[model samples]
Target: MDLNQMLSEIEGGNDEEIERLLQRYNSENNRTFTFDQKEESLRIKLCQSTLAVLRREVPFSCQRTCLETLRIMSRDKCVLSPVATREGILTLSLSQNGLQEDNLSEEEERVVVEALKCLCNVMFNSPTAQQICVDVQLAPVLCGKLHSADTWHHEVGLFTLRLLFLLSALRPDLRMCLRKDCQAVTLLTKMLEHTLDINWWLTFTAENNERVMEALKALFNLTLNEPEGEEDVRQCRVIVSLLRHVLMLKTETVEKTEELHSHAVNLLNNLPVSCLDGAGRPACASASENLKVKPEIGNTMRNKLVRLMTHVDWGFDIMSGCEEEPRPNPSEDMTEEQKEYEAEKLFKIITELTRHDMIRPMVVRPDGQLGSLEDKLREIANDDDEANNSDSD
Candidate 1:
C-alpha cells in the first residue's frame, strides 16, 4: 500500500493493518521503505497514530512494533517536529511505566527498551525534542529508573544512559539538574564501577566496555563548567580515583585502550583542578584500603599525567625547532587544531599540578635533564609573543 493509504488505515483504527505497516517500515532488510520529504503530513499522521497505539492498551507486540517504527522514523529530522511535542514526548516516555515500577515482565522490558531507543533518536535529531525533554523533567525519571539493579544489566539501562548523555550534552540546564538534582556524578560513578566489575574481579567484555564509555561520557557532560563548591570538590576526588581505575583497565587491544584512555582524559580534564591534589598520590594507604585498591593504580595515574605533560612539552619543542617547515594540512589522526587543543588541556592540567606543594615535586622533576613546568610555560609565552610579532610584521 502507498504511504498515505497505510497511514489512513492506521488512523482509521485498523490495528492489524497498523501492525503490518509498522513491521514493513521497520524491517531491517526492507531497503524499499523510504519516506519522501514531501509527505510530511503523512509522517506527522504516522507519528500520531503510532503514539496513540503506544498509549492505548495494546498488546506488547503491537506496542513494541510502534516504538520500533517510531525509532526508525525519528531518524529523519522532518518527522521529528510532531514527535518533539510535549505530549508526544510524554506518550513515548510513559510507555514504559513498568520501568518506574521496577516490575517489568520480559515483554514489558522489550517495549521499554524500544521506547528509550526511540526517545534517544528523537532527542538526538531535534533540538526541540531536547528542550522538551528538559521541560518535561525526563532526566529525573530516567535517573529513578537507573536506581534499579536489574535495569543496569539490560538494554534499558544502556539506552537510558545514552539518552541522559544526549540531554546533558545538548542542554546546559539539564547538566546542572543531573549533577545537583539527580546526584548523577555518584550514580554514574557507581555505574562505571559496576560495569568494570571493580568490586569483584575485573571482567573485560565488549558490552561492559561500551557501558563504561557511555557512563564516562555522561559524567563529562555533567561536570562541564561546574563550580567548585565543597561538595563538587569531594565528588571530583572520587571521580579522579575512578578515572585512575579507568586508565588502568585492560582493553582487548592497544587501539581500544587508547580510545578509552582518550575519553578518560577528556573527563579528567573537565574536573576542577583543586580536587586533583590526590590524583597523583597513592590511594591504597587511604580509607579506600578496605576496597583493596592497588597502590600502583595511583602510580599509573601519575605516570599518565606526566606523559601527557611531556607530550605537550615535546610538541612545543618541535613547533619551535621547525620554524621553517610549512604547517602541514590537518590529518585524520590528529588535526593541527586538535593538537593545539590537546596541548592546551595538558598544559592547564600540568600547571594546576604544579600549584600543589606535594604534586609539584612529582610533576616537575627538575634534574636538568627534563625541562621544568616553569620553563615550558615560559616557552609557551615566548611562542605567543612571536606569533603576535609576526602578525604585526
Candidate 2:
C-alpha cells in the first residue's frame, strides 16, 4: 500500500482500507520484533500506517490496539518525522469534521479526542513537527478553536492542547516556539481564568478539562524560567485565580488529587511581586489584610508537588527571605504587605524555574543563598530596635 494513498484515506475517514494496509505491513515487520514484551511492543510501531490507522479505529472494538499503538509511537523518535506529521494534521482536520456529525455519540467523540491526543504527541513533542507547527500555523488556530461553544469543536480544541502538554514533558526546549506567538500567553491564561461555567474547560469533571490541564502544565513549564515584565503580573493573577478555583472544588478526591495540588504549588512558586497585592487578594485591593504564607506552608507545597517529579529532577526545594533585610523598622515583619511580598517573591522564582527548564537546583552544596538571605533577615529584625533608639535620641 502506498503511504500517500493511506494518508488520503485517513483524511477522508476511511478506516478499512487503512487497516488492510496495516495488517500487511505488520506481517512484514513482525519478524523484526523480539518477543520480550517491551521490545515486542516496539515492533508494533514499525508499520508507518499504525498511528493514523489506530486513530480512526479508536471507536471500534479494537480500541486497545490504537491506545497501545499511540503509546508505542510516543516512546520512539521516528514516528515524529515529516511524513508522520502530515498524517497527524490530516487526523486533526478529520477530527474537526467529525465534531459536526450529530450521528456520533459522546463515546465516539471521546474516542476521537483520544485519537487527536495521539496525533498531538507528535505535533507537540516531536522535534520534526516543530517546523510543521510554524509552517501550518497550528498554535493560534488551535487556541481560537478551544473557545468555541460547540461541543465537537470544543473537544477538538482540547485535543489540540493535549499536544502542548506532551511537548512540555517530553521536550522542554520547544516551549519557546509557543512564546513567539504574541497571543500565546493570553491563549493559555484564558483557559486558567475562573469561569462561571462549571462545565467550562478548566473544571476538573468537564470532558475538556484534561486538555486544559495539559496546556496549564505546558504553560507553567514554558514560563518557568522566563524573566519578569509587565505581563508577568497578569500571569501571576491568572494563576492565583486558578488556585482559588481548584481549592473551591468540593470533591475531596479531585481537590486533593496530587496533580491539581502540584499545579497549585507550581503557580505559587512562580508568583511575581507585581502580580501580587501587598495584601494577597486576587489583585491588590485596599479592603483586605495582607496574604501571609508561612515558611512551613511553603515547605508543604514543595513536598506535595514533588511526587510528580523524579529523583533526578532538580530544584523543587525553595527557601527565601526578604530582600533588603536587617531593616531599622520594627513595623516591617508583622505587616500584611511584607508577608505578601515574601510569598510573591518565592512563588515567582519557583514559577520561573518551572516554566523554563525541568532542572532545579541540586542544593546539596549551597548556592550560598541562605547566608546572604539570613543577613538580610537580621537587618530587618532590627527595625523596632533602631526605631526605639531614634525615638530616644
Candidate 3:
C-alpha cells in the first residue's frame, strides 16, 4: 500500500509486488503523492524484483522457474523502468558469482540471458538505460565478463553485441576496443545475417520496420567500416545495400537529412582503401597511404581524427578571396618532376573534400600515437620514396 510495503515484499520475494506497486502508483489515489515517494518506492521494487516475476508472483522456489521468468520478461519489456532495471541487471550480473564451475546454474543463466535481452532493448530504446550502461560500470564489467568462459557469460554477449553494433560508431572509445577483440566482428557478422531469419524478425515484435532498418544500418556500420578483417571486401558489398535503400526513400525528406548525413560520414570516414575495388578506387584513393599514417591505433586515433578534420573541409566556406595578381601559365616551363609534385598536392585536396565534415561527421585533430593525416598524405605524395622507387630500379 505504501513505499515501505513495496520494498518489504519485493525483498521477501513477493512476485506480485512490482505490478501491485505499479498499479497503485498509477491509481487515482496515488496521483496526490509526491513524485519522490513514488519514484523511491519504484526503485526498491525494481531492485528486489527478478525477471521471473514480471507480471506475476512466485509460484515456486525452483531456480529454473525464476530463470525462465526472466527470459519471458526479456521477450516482453521494451521499456524497463529505470529504478529497478539498472539494479535488476547488476544484480543479475552479480548472481553469476555463485556458480560452482565458474558458470551459471542453467536456470540462473537463463535469468541473465532474458534479463539482458530486456536490458539491451531498454539500453537502446531508453535514453536513461543508455546512460546507466556507461554510468554504472556496465560496459567495462561487460568487457570483463566477455573475457572468458569463467564468465560463462551469455547475456553480456548479447548486450555487447547490441552495444558494439549500435553504439560503436558514435563512440570512438568503444570502436578501438571492438577492434581489439577478434570475436567482435565475427559475432556481429553472424547476427546481421540472422536478421533475415523469421525467428529473428519475430523477436522484434515491439520494434517496427523502421527501427529494424536502423538496426540493420547500425549493424552494417559496425561490420563494413569500423573494423578491417579478412571479410571486409565481402562485407563492403553487403554494406552497400544500405546506400540504395536510403536513396530510394522518396518519403524521407530533408527533416532528418542532416542527421542521416552525419551517420553517412561516420560510415565513410572509416572506409579503408581495402574497400575500394576498381570502381571504388577513386573513392578510396587515400587509403593506401592511410596504412602508412596509422602506426599504432589507440595512441593515434584522436590524432588521426585531427589530421582528418584539418585536411577535410567542413563545407562552411564558399568564397575564396584572391589578393595576388594572376600568374602566367607555367606548364611549359615546369620540369616533369615539378609538375608531378603539384598534381599530387591536388589529389590530397580532392581526398579531403570528399571526406570532409560537410559530407561526413569526421572530426580530425592532429597529434597522438598515429601519424597525422597530413603525414599520411605526404607519404602518399608522388615525391615519396615509394613512388620514386617504383619508377626506377
Candidate 4:
C-alpha cells in the first residue's frame, strides 16, 4: 500500500471514500506491515492527513472520518509527534468549532467524542502538546463540554478533564488557569458529588467505579496547594460528600472497597490542610477557624466518623439492626488480608479526620461510654504486634 498517497486520498476524498479509508486503517486484521521506520513514517503521514482534513471546511461526515483516523493514528508514539505538532494542533480549532455548534448530527457527536479521546492520547506524557492545548484555550472548550445534557458528552468531558489534571500537575501555568476559572471548579465538584451519589451504589460496574475514582483524583489535583481552590472545594462540601462516599464503599467487596477507601482518603488529604495556608503559614491560632466548618456541621461529621472508626466490622454489619454484643475477637473470622486492609483504611480515615480541630478531640479522647476511637487504635496496634511475635516464634 502507498500509505502517503492513501492518506492524501483520504484527506481530499468524498465522505464514502473517507469512511472506507478510516475503516481500512481501523481494522487490525488488515495490518500486515512490520513496525519498522517505513510503517512509522506512514503513521506520521496519516496523522498529518487527518489534521489537514479536520482543518478544512469539509462535509461533517468527512470531518468525522478525519477524527476517527486521527484517533487511530494517535495510538502510535511516532504518529503522536506529528499530531501534536503546530500544524496538527490546529485541528483543535476544528474540534472547538464542531463542539460549539448547538445542533450536531449523531455522527458529528461521535466525532466530537473521538476528538476528545484523540486529544487525550496526543497529550499523554507530552508536555508540549499540553501547552499547545492551553495556548489554544482548550480548557474553556472542555469545561463547556461538561455542561451538555448528553451523557456521552459528560463521559468524554471527564476523560479530557483527567488529561488536563495530569497536565496541570506538571504545568503551574495550567494549574493556576484552572484554579482561577470558577466554572472549572464548579463542574469538577459537581461531577464528584454526582459520582458519589447513592444511585451509583445500585447500578455500579467496575467501569463506573474507575470513572468515579478518576473524577476524585482530578478534583484532588485541581485543589492541590491553592487556598482559593480549597475554598471552592469547601463550598462544594466535598469533605461531607467524600465521607458519604467512604460510608457507601462498605457495599463493595473487600478489595474493591479498600481501593475506593484509599482514593477517598487521598481526596480528603488533598483538602487544604487547616494548620497550613497556601503560603505555608499557620498564623491562625484557632484551627477550627481555619477549617471554615460550621460548628454544628463539624460536630455532625465528627460523630459520624467516630462511629465509623469504632465499628466492629465494615459494610452492612456496621448498619445491622440487631444489637448484638461487640465481638471479643472481631479479627478471628477475617482473613489476614481482610484484617490488614480494614485496619489500614480505618487508620487513614481517622488520621485525615483528626487534622481538623473540631474532629481532633473525638479522635484522640481517651475515654468513652464504649471506649474511644483511640482505644480501637491501640487494640489494632496490639493485634499487629502479637501477629508479628507469632510469626517470629
Q: How close is each model in CA RMSD to the real structure?
A: 15.1, 17.7, 18.7, 16.7
Higher-ranked by TM-score: 3 or 4: 4
Query: What does candidate 3's lDDT look like per residue over 73-138, in tens digits?
Result: 332233246323566555444543334324555555554554455555445555565665555655
Lowest-lDDT window of 10 residues in candidate 2?
315-324
lDDT of 2 by residue, 1-393 (tens): 344554455456545554455445445444442234544333434434455454543544344344334543454554445335665655544544445434456656665665566566555556666656555655555555545424334665566666556644555555565655535556666665533245433435644455445666767766766445666566667666666555444222544455555665575565655554542335442455322332233434333444433333222233321122343865455678887887899899897986696635432224443344445556667987899899999
Better candidate number, 3 or 4, judged by lDDT: 4
- What is the alpha-carbon lDDT for the whole of candidate 3? 0.45
lDDT: which candidate is best? 1
lDDT of each: 0.74, 0.52, 0.45, 0.62
Best by TM-score: 1
In model 1, how large is the Cα lDDT of residue 348?
A: 87
Clashes of 4: 0
| Off by more than 4 A, model 1 | 28-35, 100-103, 149-151, 198-203, 253-255, 281-315, 318-393
Return the candidate ranking by lDDT, descending: 1, 4, 2, 3
Indicate whether candidate 1 or candidate 2 has the larger TM-score. 1
**lDDT by residue (tens digit), candidate 1, 1-393:** 367887777877666777887898778523534567787787788888788787787788888899888887887787787789999999888886455446667878888888889889888889888888888888888777656634454677777888888888877777777888888887887777666664334535666667777888898898887665888888888888888778778676766766678788889888877777856655543553332222223446554444443233322343222123456665558978889998899888887876774454323445434545666788779999999999999
Q: Candidate 2 — which residues are off by over 4 angstroms?
A: 1-46, 49-111, 123-125, 149-158, 168-182, 194-212, 225-232, 248-256, 278-393
lDDT score, candidate 1, position 301: 50
lDDT, candidate 4, 315-370, per-residue tens: 22444322444568888899999999999999888878887634644354443234
Better of 1 and 4 by lDDT: 1
